[model samples]
Target: MKAGKLAALGAALLIGAAPAWAEAPSAAPGAARIADTATDEARLMALFRDDARREDALDPLALIYRGTAPDPAALRRLFTDSQLRAQRGSVIQSLALLRRIDRRRLGAERQISYDVFLAAKREEAEWLRPDSIALTAVRPFNHFGGLHIEFPSLMAKDGAVKYEDSADYRTNLALIRAFPTVLDNAVARFRQGLASGVVESRLTTANMIAQIDALLAQSPEQSPFYSPVREFSAGIAASEQPALRAAYGAAIRDEVLPAYRRLRAFLNDEYLPAAREQVGIAAMKGGPGLYRRYAGRQTTLPVEPEVIHQLGLAEVARIQTGMDQVKRELGYGGTLKSFFDVIRTDPRYHPKTREELARGFAEAARQVDALVPQYFSRLPKTRLAIEPYPAYREKFEAGGSYNQGAPDGSRPGVFFYNTFDLPSRFLTGITTLYLHEGAPGHHFQISLAQEDASLPDFQRFGGNNAYVEGWALYAETLGYPMGFYKDPLQHWGTLDDEMLRAMRLVVDTGLHAKGWSREQAIDYMLANSGMGKSDATAEVERYIAWPGQALSYKIGALTIQRLRKKAETALGPRFDIRAFHDQVLGSGALPLPILEAKIDRWIAARKAG
Candidate 1:
């Protein structure tokens, strides 16, 4: 992995020049002039390799969000356009980054390094996953044909607007070119798993099929995707010449539909037959090991499964104790579970309309954003937009999500509230949710990281799942101190929200690792956390589908909390929350250990100062 190589190079550079950067603000008296010019070509080659690795990592996201088409003609045209841009960009970026390395200085390793670079480049060029997957599994998901509309107009109003620019199209084309090769390997893996009687959930396959059918059922002209195209074509008659419209229409009707139909056929004829009814990553090849790798990657620590399991157990216990205290304070409950029932049945918590519910969240987020500047001095320059979840994807999205803005300042960060089901958008724990998902959490951390140019691309753009989610969870805990839980009910609501994360630790580990059935996990959550049955069921299913990812929230939050306490104690009255936060966020999203090390360094520096 280029991970170790990158770290080694960074360390080597640091060791060679730490004195230069770390010297006092005033010049060191009589310091010998250091004009060291020893450059490591080996290190440069490693950086080249790491840059390729970075591209490989980002390719999947580009493919997933580009657009959807229902038929072969449209799909092929999209392939010709969107996917092609992504692939070409990946190869060009890889080659360009590789070229930046000084090859001649590598001595004997020069040819081998060049060969490795070429091999990696070829591999990227040869990847067919984006196209193949779209042609197979993904095609079924792209129900929107040429109706090409981007909706929720909430984004456009909030200044998070982005139009299809030539650059966007260029990037899309790059992915198309690389899509085929990636898909080939993926299909081979899928087939091998099928041969061994190991496959994905039957439910996942069914969902894909159902989504595809919905798309196909829509008239070609009525598709959400086509409307935008139509509007665009009509609006700029000169630009949307006859040839372009015909080509667009032809692509939608021909290439896209056939791709969807082919995928539908495979799901029905082959893949679905071998699919398992169960929903957990545990059943996959190297299941436990793979999860551990994910855990390590997400948390940026070498946390063992057993340790996490124990941590989950402890969190569940601690939160349940807090809930008991809250119950007594409220003075109207039988058991804690019954209080949860009361909250669920309570009318005051539920909003009457989707718009009302969405406005509630947006207002709460705005309130929090207002308070954030007091605590954080190093805030991101980028803007934030609040929007309702897109309608077509609401069924798949859990309550809310935060999609990062573009890196080049063209787009603002987005926080989407899924208000499809109004009753589901109750005030219960809403304030805490806002804090965790928006201000002082994801918005603060992710935005700051993206804005930091001093950090390497990987640190700024890449992330440790644990640190990001964990920090957010920690932010929720910070609400009370910030005077957010002024309402007693909101205070109880905050505790309830924390209890949910605690429950995730147990339920997620239960379903995937501990042989707990889906129903069992759902019941445990519903009874313990007082969540609605629908919410509880969906949460359990998400855990089953995505494994160890749920564990990162509590685990990551705990590490940050621990570090903060350590810093506070070390600096005493001199410790500034703003400075401490700047130190934490300015470095970007690093692994927990790296984060801790950075924090420790910051603390010691404060002490010395």
Candidate 2:
């Protein structure tokens, strides 16, 4: 999973906008027509910049995440319904302007931008429909990607927000004071969900309640929100420190903690009883259609749930064969199912301490870094850091996740590992997990795009799940050529990780589309791979909380792999691995179809040369 405010911004862009070269062309000959085309392209570029500025103004957090300062008033309005309506209206207007542009007038690069921007607006329009918002806006959050989980991290010292000066501290203090409104609004939305029968699942409701309980347990001084003021930056005068600390503590005690308590009471007393026992969204009112929309939006393709389910099954079977081969090589004397049990229960494969786990990942990073230049021609300027999830969050988080750094390299990207259940954490997965979440994965893909000033902001900062997660998943395969998988244990780990993505294809579709119980999904995962029971349960609940998202991993990786094979087969010895990689990452994240089309064009250009 990708964490942080910037990741949310990327998803918002994917889920959400555009502009005009809206005038009709003149009926002039030769030079006059060429001038019209150039004018249209120039106008379109201006429109892109203008729309991006409006978006930043609408959500000041976008600016903060990109290392730019934002108006403090805009920050206070971040999560309100009025803001949501304004964003929806913006999408509608942008799409209308985009439709007026003449696609034939643009050159190749502009044409690609035109297509991506149009597709994003059209998808956002579908999601913003009244019927769609009825199902989604009412259930504003879940345990997985909820603001309740992400907001604290965003406000922390290591998070996206800056603390360079006293003014910056003052801005952060104002943001913290405004957090209560966001929490109260969530309570209002949950009530709406209850009334409309679009409520969250009981499992998710329970998890969220537990999370809030953890937050409320902390005193004002210990709160993550107070972290910024704990150590003042050099820019703050000695005279101002005492008052700033007192004000922050008062905000947490008087406002933040009380709001959390109120939200907690509502969930435990009112919402939990109302939350559905059935985990899948298919069980809710208008759920099936909502699931279909989520599936389409997430994958960027019109695909049937049953077809994806079938594809997942085939991939799982193919991967299990490889698992069986690894089992034989390890001299295991039992069936694959029994082998899974041994791997899960074996103490040697599990880390004894958090430090041990961190060391393993750090070593993996060192090894992968040494070999990176052999695989790719370009690298990111933004640095990557490894850290464990905060204590309050580790219990519910996945095995690992990446949060992007500032666009200007002011902050380094962080790879957060889970150390809550140390015994349940597998040391075998360190290399593969680091490859997927850290270097050459999210860290490289996101940082490289943000560093390039030439691309439009939409291409630089906006992306869909299919391309973003898919590229990370594809990065895992690079382990083979890099030789980390040559060690049989590491090879087994890679197979297990691949199995996780393959199983997501089956398990996610099964839970949402086929009405599989949460337990059923967990049991299937345990039976198929070496994952621990705790990890497996977390994975199933994640799918239940956010449907259709898991399907992107394998769906995306398979597409990229197929395209690479096509390039290799066509070019024969002329194909350069580094050049192919650069082509893929060059334009940032794109919808699957758009990426495929772009790669095909590159192939033709290379062959012609």
- TM-score result, candidate 2: 0.93
Q: Write the per-residue lDDT of candidate 1 for residues 415-462, one digit (tens) a residue.
A: 777766666556766788778777878877888877776554545665
Least accurate 10 contiguous residues by lDDT in model 1? 12-21
- CA error at residue 540 for candidate 1, angstroms: 1.6
- Global lDDT of each model? 0.59, 0.84
List RMSD in Å for every model shown: 10.2, 5.5
Give each model a TM-score.
0.75, 0.93
After superposition, candidate 1 runs with Cα above 4 Å error? 1-189, 222-224, 233-246, 328-331
Candidate 2 per-residue lDDT, tens place, 249-337, comes to: 99999998999999999999999998899999899899998888788778877767887888888888999999899888888979999
lDDT of 1 at 139: 22
